[model samples]
Target: MTTVGFLYPGHFAEDEFPRMEVILDTTIRLVVNRTEPGEDDRRPDTLRTLGEPERLAAGVEELRRAGVESVVWASTGGSFVYGWEGAHGQTTALARAAGLPASSASLGFVQAVRALGAARVAVAATYPEEIARLFSEFLAAAGIDVVATHSGGVTTAAEAAAWGPDRLKELAVAADRPEADAVLLPDTALHTTAHICDLEELLAKPVLTANQVTVFEALRLARRRTWAPQLGTLFAAREAPPAPVGWRPAGE
Candidate 1:
């Protein structure tokens, strides 16, 4: 079995990892290590602290012991709040600390967008508009265009975790634009594994959720793929292409 480690920020929605293990092919397994919950706020300052190198390093020992082939910082807000360059540095430091291939949910979204050959996407974010705008900027830096964005104005991870499938579908539908090739839900705190297929069908296009892309990125780093149609289009594909040469976050 191939194992992908995730350094999740808190208790919220970490259960999605285990749920994915059950839904995905038996050859792939997920090991999640919850890091310190610095604060529940989604503000940029709080998120920067949540994704700091020290906190990510503190969780590496557990994933290392689990024998994970790759590690990912699984919090979308935590990583994206730092901007593209800072997010790259975050994963680079985590890789050095864990001695394994490393990535984050923010970078995963960019990779997933490219993997699908999508140039423009719409964002359904659970963060406030200011923070959601930062995610758009991050995507822009990575060459993905954000055609539309619908911020849910939810300020805390705990609140976002409480959202259900109906709410998720509404957010996606509201954010989708005809020009966008796909819709992206960029909050790992939101539970989406169970509703990926449903959302994609509702939008009539590819729907990439934070937890889904996070796992995809980890597997890409490990040079592995699992056939899990229930996980959405990203996992249903035959294979995930390796990041392009000189990609800012090179795989180990």
Candidate 2:
């Protein structure tokens, strides 16, 4: 049985687990850590504390012991710190530590944009407006143009996890731009994957979210071909799986 392990904060969208289970066919096991909200722990905040790499590395080791075949960082902000190289290096490090393949939300977002052939995109974020700037730079490095952005200023990881899917769709529609060919919701905690097909129908374009891309990217790395309408266009497209035994780290 192939296994995918997700490392994340204490809370997350209730919708994500069900979606993952159906898409991955009961191959997913969610492993969680503390929320670790710092001084700015509020209901509507986006300031995320960078989790210690040492702590994350240890967590990956535990997942490996549980027979996980691949691991994914389920938090967007936590994995975006090292920029492109940082994101790649961190996943490689975790893969080495766990003796399994690995990936992250941010790096996966880049791949999804490319898979969709999206040149200019509008991003809807669950983070504060300030954090949106960081993602814009990260996407630029990946050769994606940020045509527009909107932030909901969600403060805590718990709150982001608790946010309703209907509300998130509203944010995505509000954040979309007429000029963009695609829309991205860049927070794993926001639970936007299950709504991707709906969003596409509404906006008439590709819709991507962190968790959806994260899973797709990992499956690609593992040479697994997955197609799920609920997960959106990235998965809907048919492409050759990544070469086995030489999975380049994410963002490479």
Candidate 3:
């Protein structure tokens, strides 16, 4: 089985890893963020505080130990909350520290869009307005055009994670724009693998969600481009293999 990993940055609302495994019908290894001594509450602010390069590097190290073929920093805002440059460095540190292929949910979003040949996308964010705005900026930096965006003003990961498939469908349609080539739901806390195709059928456009793209990016990084179609159009993509990046062990 192809095993994937994620550096989860907060207390998740759902047991997301196992769900992805069931839907994708594969193995998913995960490393949740641990609080240091005297660490603050497990909230959005805490996720940001814990998103430092060294701290994230440590988490990736653990995922490597778990035998993850590929891993992603599976927190949307944590990956992009610091902006494009910072997130880039965070994934770079993860690759170097884990000596495994690494990607972030935020970076995965950008790459996913390009892979889908989508230039214009509408964003459905669970973050408050401020954090949602930063995601727009990060996408812009990646050269993807944001045709429209919406923020639900959600305050925490647990809250976003608690949303069921119905809510996920509602959010994606609400965020869709007539001009957008696709709709993006940028929250790793959310569970969308179950409803990705349903959302796409409703919107008649590609619907990319955090968990789906994170897995896709991990599979790509780990040399598992050949995937089954049940995950979503993102996985059903039968294009030629993405150019492979060289893999090196940590501490090279």
User: Candidates' TM-scores?
Assistant: 0.94, 0.82, 0.84
- Residue-wise C-alpha lDDT for candidate 1, range 1-252, written one tens digit per residue: 898899988899999999999988888889998898887888899999999998899999989998899999998888988888999999999999999999999999998999977878999998999999999999999988899989999999999999999999889998999888889999999999989888877777788999999999999999997778888777776865342232211111
| TM-score winner between candidates 2 and 3 | 3
**What's model 3's overall lDDT?**
0.73
Give the per-residue lDDT digits (tens) of candidate 2, residues 1-252: 556676765555535755576665454444433334344343213332454456567677557666666777766777775677777887888778777888888888887777766778998887777677677778888888898889888766667777776887788888899788778888777767556777777777778888777777766666677656556666664663331223221112
Write out the backbone clash pairs for model 1.
none
Q: Model 1 off-target regions past 4 Å?
A: 240-252
Give the number of colliding residue pairs in candidate 1.
Answer: 0
Candidate 1 vs candidate 2: which has greater lDDT? 1
Off by over 4 Å in 3: 25-47, 240-252
What TM-score does prediction 1 earn? 0.94
Model 2 shows how many backbone clashes?
3
